[model samples]
Target: MELSPVLLYGEAEGMVRSLQSFPLRDTGSGGWLKQHEYIEKLNMQAILNASAGQEEMIKDLLVTHGKVSSLIRELITVEIWKQKVFPVISQLQDFQPRSTFPLYMVIHHEATIINLLETILYHKDVCESAEDLVLDLIDYCHRKLTLLLSRCSAGEIAGQDRLLPSSASETSSLEELKLQAESLEFDVALKCLSVLRYITDHTDSLPLSITTRLLNTHNLPCVLVELLHSCPWSRRSKGQLQKFESGRWLSVPAEDQQKMTKLDGQVWISLYNLLLRPECQQKYNIDGFTRALISSHRDPHRSAAEPSGATAISQLFVSERTGAPKEGADLRAGSRSLGLHYQREFWEMEGDSEAPGEACVLPQ
Candidate 1:
């Protein structure tokens, strides 16, 4: 006998309910393998239901089952497993597996939950449901963002689509897994930014422990300042500006170059919430390093409004940050005066001819 639609929904809901109380401790390799599949299925169904505008059932299933904390634990568990277990498995001489696809799925598991959380965490209930484990989620996001920044700063990170190379024979090895992690790093960092912003939105109701972890412990405001300094989502490639969008880096035209992308907006909005929120202000330490770093990097002049001569001159002032005047002072008036003075001299000497091509570098 065929089940009615209501029965099917109930059956599906029951499965999730059973999975909710799923044991997290001492789940052996076999158990973890099974757990991986279950999480993947839940994530896939969640996405499909979300797209079909039937998110209520999935939301209730996730919250009622208390799956958020489980997801957090599982995410950290996988990360730890990757760090501790995968390397030893890679070295075992007789451990050839039939397929590396399972291993790949294990690595991709973190991304799946990240995607699901991004979809559902917008609701206040979901955020509240996370409870104290929200601190774990915050730490997880911090690690990813910090890793992204360090890689970028060290000049080790590639463009969004650039993957770590792997030969066919090396597909299932730890080396290949490392490569996959590198490839997923950019997307993961972007998702983390969104998740952090959502958490920031609900900070007023967050537990004191979560607030302490986010503000004092993590110094997320300072971390965000670093992101603004080194924007991971956009970069210069052979003089062309490429922005990460729809999974790959696409060339951005000159007109839209100055526009802030979603990644930038996410960081800035999170910063606004963290630094400006009354509760956050009391918790965060806004010391000299934070103040100077923020003041030094923020460009004051309009990108479009300024003349090329003025723009080039402004960079000199920015680069001279130490000796540069304080943040609120009117450097614009002085810089424009200096720019006009130089423009007149160049015009008088060259008779309105264009300056040398290497005269000034455009902002990337």
Candidate 2:
């Protein structure tokens, strides 16, 4: 006999009701059923089945795995945190993919992740597990930025692009190099700050490692300085633009060096701009840093200043640790400067103390 839709529905309903009233003293009620053993069984089955497709399953499996694993990891992380498990961040961090997805995806995810990570880090006391998540997020961002930066031409690619845009002929000139410096832009603000901070934190290595690299690498120093200068981290160079032209050497008297060594107003200003980066200020111990100045090999144009630019020629870039840069605040004003602007906004509003501007060294 054929079943009617109503009869099938009625039977299904009755069966559902019957099944729902379970604890009807079932047969399998009593053993030492290892609570989550069943759960492990199901997950293992799914993982095994998913693995059958290999890399093709990576996207889907990783998604599912990330959810489940992240959930478990998070629970453990919380427990660890509750116990003040500060040391576990490194361990938890190790679970994340050492590398990340493509640059576009990374850039897309960065801000959201950063904000989330920031919240987690802020909960250092209440939820120590959050620190691991934050550290992992930072590592992911660093890897993404590193990859993107590698794909990029260099720090001065922006300048070069502007000089020639795409013309091969444009690359051979110093003007093109200067333009390369002008065009550098960051995919992430924090990453830019991180780079600047790295330099300042490692100020002691300036003349030795950084200086040598700066002199040897094309437009990297200018690119880095420009990144810091243009942000809210410090002051920007103004007078230094006069040096951007490639042939500035011809204009200088025969004896003067190409790079300057005068710890002029701008030089100090630039140093201060570099100093304010939280990475540098927060991470570095400037006390023991010593930058041995080798004046002879250095250019006469700019001062063969100390590698640890802790000292100020003019106090313009210097800040009084607790607050922002003070106007004419013991800082000598000079036209030629070396610092980058760190303020997000281009200019100060009226009555707000103006950032004493300085000249930036343009790289042509």
Winner by lDDT: 1
True-structure RMSD for candidate 2: 21.9
Indicate the worst ten consecutive residues by lDDT in candidate 1: 355-364
Candidate 2 Cα errors over 4 Å, as ranges: 1-134, 154-364
* Model 1 residue 335 CA deviation in Å: 25
Worst 10 residues of 2 by lDDT: 288-297
lDDT of each: 0.66, 0.30
- Model 1: per-residue Cα lDDT over 313-356, one tens digit each: 33333433445655314544444444444334433433334452
TM-score of 2: 0.24
List TM-scores for all candidates, in order.
Answer: 0.73, 0.24
**Over 4 Å off, model 1:** 1-8, 20-31, 48-55, 93-95, 159-174, 299-364
Per-candidate clashes, comma-separated: 0, 36
